[model samples]
Target chain A: MENEFSIEVRDLTKMFGGFTAVDHISFEVRHGEIFGFLGANGAGKTTAIRMLCGLSLPTSGKAEVAGYDVFRKPEMVKRNIGYMSQKFSLYQDLTVSENIYFYGGIYGLKRKVIFQKTEELLEKLDLKHARNTLIRDIPLGWKQKLAFSVAILHDPQIVFLDEPTGGVDPITRRQFWDLIYEAAKAGVTIFVTTHYMDEAEYCNRISIMVDGRIEALGPPAELKTRFQSQDMDEVFVKLARG
Target chain B: MRTIYFILFKEFRQIFRNKAMLPIIFVMPVIQLIILAYAADFEVKNLKLFWIDKDQSQLSRQLLSKFEGSPYFRLTQADMSREAAETAMERDEVDVVLEVPAGFERDFLAEKKTQIQLTANAIDGVKGGFASAYGQAVIRDFYGDFLEENAARLSWQPPSGGTINIASANWYNPEMDYKTYMVPGVLALLVTMIGAFLSSMNIVREKELGTIEQLNVTPLKKTHFIAGKLIPFWAIAIFELAFGLVIAKILYDIPMLGNLFLLFGLSAVYLLVVLGLGLFISTVTETQQQAMFISWFILVIFIFLSGLFTAIENMPPWAQQLTYINPIRYFIEILRSLLLKGSGWAELQQQFYILLGYAVLINGLAIWRYRKRS
Candidate 1:
């Protein structure tokens, strides 16, 4: 069924040998929705996201991302989605400008368009002076901001941020969210996974996964009220404990 | 096409930017070519020979003269005593000593009996063998003439020549320059080392640095990525082969008897096999260390069996059979044959076809094993 949602997963499961990582999990993400996929370590969040990004195959069931099947048309899924993992997505040896052009070139952007987009990104991120600085020499916070900007550079239909701000200072992370808000305002669907509860409140909707199953799915305030807790941390603790 | 170009651009940038790897790629072959061609030499020539003649007779003079006439032995002294000859051998100034006892011509004329002694240093077994054999050949020839001269004095009839004369000459490399033979083999080794070691480590480095994961998420095709990785090394290895060949010709006067195009054509196909093997190794290994170990294991086996130093025909039956599977064996055979014997397509078709089949199989396996997902 084609609807306002950009992603629809049905009974998606992944098995390594006999152990099931993601067992019969299903979900839908609306267009331009800021989806915060929340789970404890080893809750199959990575497994599920890998399937949606078309980087991996699902053992059974179906997933459609950007109107493309995750199983049959993974390349199509990859082409339409921008992905950033918390574990350093940019090339360390390449200059800031070089990384931008290289990533843009691989995305099949024309030279002129990559140049134009690079200029806009540099100006927006206030990185005009550090264009030739190697990513290795750049500070961690600036690197994160640059990574986020590059991820959405292609104007992909959806952006997957896998723990994009893990060790950044509070102020830098606050500014990082500002960039996310700017991208969301431009109608790009944001699919972010993070451990921070305050980051959960910023999402339009969130799903808490427990033991390969979705225990709760709703707005943070609704989940807080339903769980009889004041914050997402407590809601997470209540669902994860049982 | 555009994707392939971008990947190539990125790969080239990284390769050139690497400070530790740049000198290894460009400078190493030149050094190895000059040093190993001379260092790895096995052919023995110019044996230093010192002789002591106590008889001072015409017969003893004839024997010493025979050694001087030969091209393989360089005569250092004729009047030196046995003790002096021993000192020369000890000082490493001579490889052999020939001592002729005080046997006048009367012994051969009256009784046809005499004795001579030849001693050789065997520090290098092959060199010693050549020296002893050459010394014996010179003595045997002198004996043949001596027997003919003394035959009339004896009561028995004897023929002019005692043994059948076997005529032979060296072919292909007539001069027997060891460097001429070894330089091509060294070239083969250099190319193999570069293609196998570098290609094996390329993907593993990506895996270690977490770039492979980033690249996998893009719209880039797997074939484009592999090709981009393969092409740069392929070009570098082929360039190394050409560079080595030029050095071999200039330094060693190595014969380039065959078609240069065929050598390069076959090298390109052979590279696919080794590069594919490298890529296969990389796909199976997680870290650069694992890939390096595996690559080294495979390279060692291929090099030993390639007939660079020893002949494959000399190997035992089972070992000879094992050499059939080695890609290096075929390439080195093609290299030596084309470089020395000037072999053509008809002479080298079997080796070429084997490498072609090997290339397809190995590259196919490498591509199949490479997973986009963890």
Candidate 2:
């Protein structure tokens, strides 16, 4: 049963002082599933993702990531999961290859393995020329793609991406999703949080969080039908207003 | 271990790549050392003086000439009026005012003593004290010579047939070079200031750059991350200290009487205390700016309480008590005692032990706090 699901949550709650940031929410993500966590700003999407990534402890309830309990086995969970934060997290002072090597090294990859992976990743991203270039000098779209690559470079069971494509253009967002689809095809489960309804449509399944509670959860087509809407955008608007 | 190594490699790359970091680590400390050693001077010299001599007798003339011969005093005006000299002092023209009144020889012959006024401007108390002492010595010398030469003419008998002579010697610093006294203290400061500043700002810079969040979500051990961050800065600071010591030896000729191994050993432990304080500050602060602000505040206290500028014994009792907790004070004391006094480990074991305790306590708290937070 644990092998079938990548993430298991039952009544996961997080609070800061007197304010409840994440209410008791329960969900499960299957192996290789593209699960979109959609919500407006301050709707607790980021907080929920933080708990799944083992970056924050839940105030109450049981949660497990990549078959490891987040509370009891957070270190193990961290070992099995990869994360890309909303804010760009690569060392801007380091070169692209240096960034790749650094993340791979921390993830416990062998130096030879890191070297091999570096050549393969640079070729695949068509960034071989920019390998020696500083991250600050790189283009924004390329930087985002590079960040996502570094996050999953460890070959974690699940990859958590929090608003991985916030400020990119529509074409770049599509290009970013192409990378996500390629990873999903290779049997990597992606747990991503974003407010973009269009990106919600690309997910196999998504949960709409409203004020710390998951108001709707289903396939995008099913959600659109259930809300009597044309697309995820209309469904989100109707659900948010109610 | 490999994780720590990787992190260290990455940290070194970033540190070396940073444009401002190299100068901050290497060039700036040496610059500060040379500047501070030369400029933090305590010796005062060439005190300016004004004189008002009313008596035309050879006694008064000879008294005025005595001041003229001394190297310490610069007699700017010889025939200035009392009112004019007082005005000169008021206007910051002279550091001292020498006044010899009329009938000075008659009064001296009758009473064996006469008053000669030496007034010093007390704006700079140290300079004023030196000025007054130098002036009085000259006047006393003139009086002694006059009494000896004119003994038959005046028929005056000396109160004491014999006078006591005192001889003084400066032991460790034979030349009494203030540079020798200041070099070790400033070097200690150079090591502590730059090391603490860099370490304290390290983690917070990651926080500002959003890298800590990324690292937090990974399998990298907390202890490994801390060690990686600290080891590079620690090594760099030790290397910088060695460089400064070499410069001190060549440039200032500061003595290194104690064992080099012991000095380096103590310095290593002392750096841990400093770096740990920085790490603790980094963990608590939210931004690099806040961390830098707190580091500045702590550094100001460290420099002042370390007795780098003023002797700790001379501080108020309360401030003296504060030095008990200041790590920099113990460090500066250890450095000076080793380099200047040739103190052995047994003589300096107390300082070594206190620094060890501090290293353990501060690093423990910083590690515990960081682990608890994550």
Candidate 3:
């Protein structure tokens, strides 16, 4: 908490009715670090991310995002963080520039700022030619990339990507990581969730979630060595099964 | 504020892009206004009639000629027997049946009193009643004329020369054209439907597409987000209303006697209520299909109870009590009164206040129910 970590979760818990979805999970995402959260189906990765993003209330424990308390100052937390979900969360009927302007506007960016950001983002993504094209007509891989770009259009302190690369081709996945690297280079913390074990190797630090709790938290290399495995996949299998 | 604008812009883009919704929003109302206006006339026309003139005398023949000459009734058959007249009435071919008793002329000459029997279909009671009244009036006129002519022949005169005492005048729509009354009400119905139907699907669509989580993570306040989503549909609903009114005026010859600005202003306020209800529904429902189904169900009840097709006063007491809560009832009433009766603010202040309350209450409920956590 004393350090300049962008996100800090201390024994965070979230429950729906009588069922616990994210149970007493504690972790930290350092500034500018790419943290990978890996989990199987219903592994509570989404629930935990939701709590950290100020999108859901934790049943107990506490967390802070960009130095703002999750419960008492969730609005501040929301303002400093960006989020992209697996489903390509954007208005499909809207054009690329329209989506950027809309999301940027919601984040309280000035019109001139939104205009400037829209021009810069489209050029950076090489989407200038299709800026006016409806998102529904764009290729799926481009849509995902554009969605990622839109999420961080306001230059938030942290960007949360919930399985952002799901259903994308390997080449596009690689390109998507390049964008994440670029954002990380700019001192923006990247908190991402994925089922793709291979992606965990690219993170600065990685956590494995199983049955609503964090099973392992460390750099990819350290986690693999500690579990006596050759790769992160084997390490996850050992920890998730245990 | 900017976020809400973005939401609104996106919503408009989506509405324009969806081919099916555009027609449902804009075209359907105009078509309904045209078709229903033509079909929903309370003034019965082309009425088929059968008369039993038992005497077949010159005087009876003259009375039958009066029925033939009247525009209200098309004398389809002159049956000699009472049984044939009754059969024609029951078979639905004839809406009205007249029985001129055997000694009608004789009794009129002797005692100055005669009776005629008129039977009409009572299924559509209002239409049947109007037809019956028309038939009775025509017969009364014929009898009065007969008495005048008879008095001249006998060289004897009664007081007032057998002149009838009744004078009738129809209010609002003197010509009794259904289109003039129905078009305005339908405009209200259409505007409300667009607001409730389209807005109900707005947030649920994001939820179904799994983008609600993205919106949840935005820095936008809940109220701002909801406002952004609702305002565009509200504007579109108003636009649709305007278009419907234009069509009503141009195509159907609907009068615009009241201030157009007042109509639009009231429509804008009413649109907020409907759009707010739609957003509230979207927040509660999980799927677009559920939103649509629930909206349809609510709309059916609203339209039936809206006093668009029937007078609210004619409904049962308990049902009439429910009309006080229905926003459509007031809107339709205001629109019709203003458009047809040229009613001013003073005449419609009660309805205006009720609609204003509905607009505020519904939007507040929508904002309250839209939780940041869920």
Candidate 4:
């Protein structure tokens, strides 16, 4: 049977020696959905994303990403997903075009395809003038947008973004979200982790994690009414405090 | 294969763009080689000598004059007593002492043979031994002159059988130029430094910059990543070798006596051993500083044990055995043979095969140690 969910986890646990970093957590993300994974600092959001992205192996549990077992077939999962870390991970010494070319080349895309994608991506972001500019020479906002573009340049089935917009102006953050919405509309599953409560409202569905456990999961409006809160900010604070 | 090519292309672009990195890669080694060539020499000169002659005979005077005439020794006349001469040696004022006993002239004329005691400070043993040997040769030549002068005083008969005389010749470096011996060793060092230092820092820099995280999530194969890292540094180090050789030819007048292709071929394998070692170090280290420290520690040992300055034969049996695994030592041996002795593939087969083994084993281990999932 074809898998309906893009990512599925059943009792995923990761331990470092005696301490458990991620407790037995279970969740599923639907295809083409904007899934907001919300938690306070050290609430196992990053750990969960790492396991699902196939960068870290779970100590015990089952995780299927893009219909491939994360534990048994991580390479297949890797080929089918894209990742943008919280830190600006592109080569600062390299130009924007070079960074895109490198990422696309590593994903085994054809040169002509990469060229076409580069042109389109630059035009869409209105960064045509900054095409040959070094990554370090650009503003933080532009680097973040370019990072997201490079991550999805391979057109993976799912894209994992770990706190991609950590620190940016409100307008830039909103613009960054617009890019995410556009990618989502193209049927790319976006699994984003973030601290900004307002940005969490943009997700179609949200799961609030408290100390490695999913305390709340549903649509944002449903979660707000269930928690008797006005917005995602109050729901997050109430869930974290509990 | 294409993944490796792309990574390599990216690496080269980044390497070429860094303003500091280009000078370090291209210019620094050549400058170090030229300066170090003039400084690293084994030839000892200007040894100080002290003489205390108890025998005031003409023969003793002649011997003292001989020491003064030779350019290697400088005679000190602070005090003629044995105690004073020993004190001078203790103070590092003199390196050798000649003590002639009282009956030297009487016994030499009567008994045809007399002994002169020569004492040398054997602290720097190599220099001390050479100095003492020079003193002995001067005395022997003086003895021959004495025999000629005393030929009329007493007729001496020769032995029936003729004595044998030994003659020696230096094959390639007939004048024993230390520069010729050192240029190839220094060239080997240049390659080792570039291969070890640059590559060991490559991955760790990515880790420090958080770029490795982005790479880990991608579908790049472990073998492909390793090959990508290896190929760029390997090609650069090979270019470095060729460049240094041309500089050696122009500046030092050192000849490429053997087949250039064979030398280049062996150097390619040796570069793998060095670059693999660097990549292996990178996998274990968490930061660029730690990688630099660890590679520096290992490289110091490799340089000292490579027989660049000291002879491998002079080391202990176990240390000599350890040199067998040192890639730099093998390269130095191959280079010296090729540049000085004009050694061909027939003669260099042993070194070539060992390097091949090293290339395979080290690169295999490096690729094995590098994991995509972790």
Candidate 4 segments whose C-alpha is farther than 4 A from its true place: B51-61, B69-71, B75-81, B99-115, B157-164
CAPRI class assigned to model 2: medium
Question: For this target, which candidate reaches the highest lDDT against the unseen true structure?
Answer: 4
Candidate 3 chain B has its poorest 10 consecutive residues by lDDT at B155-164
Docking band of candidate 4: high
Assess each model's interface with DockQ, reporting 2 decimals per model: 0.61, 0.71, 0.72, 0.81
Q: How does each model score on TM-score?
A: 0.89, 0.95, 0.94, 0.94
Screening candidate 2 with a backbone cut-off below 3 angstroms (N, C-alpha, C), the clashing residue pairs are: none
The C-alpha RMSD of each candidate to the native structure, in angstroms, is 3.7, 2.1, 2.4, 2.4
Name the candidate, 1 or 3, with the larger DockQ value.
Answer: 3
Better of 2 and 4 by TM-score: 2
| Docking quality band of candidate 3, CAPRI definitions | medium
Arranged by DockQ, best first: 4, 3, 2, 1
Which candidate's DockQ is highest? 4
What is the DockQ score, from 0 to 1, of model 3?
A: 0.72
User: What lDDT is reached at residue A46 by model 1?
Assistant: 84
Off by over 4 Å in 1: B45-106, B109-111, B117-129, B141-167
Model 2 over residues B256-303: C-alpha lDDT tens digits? Answer: 999989999999999999999999999999898899999999999878
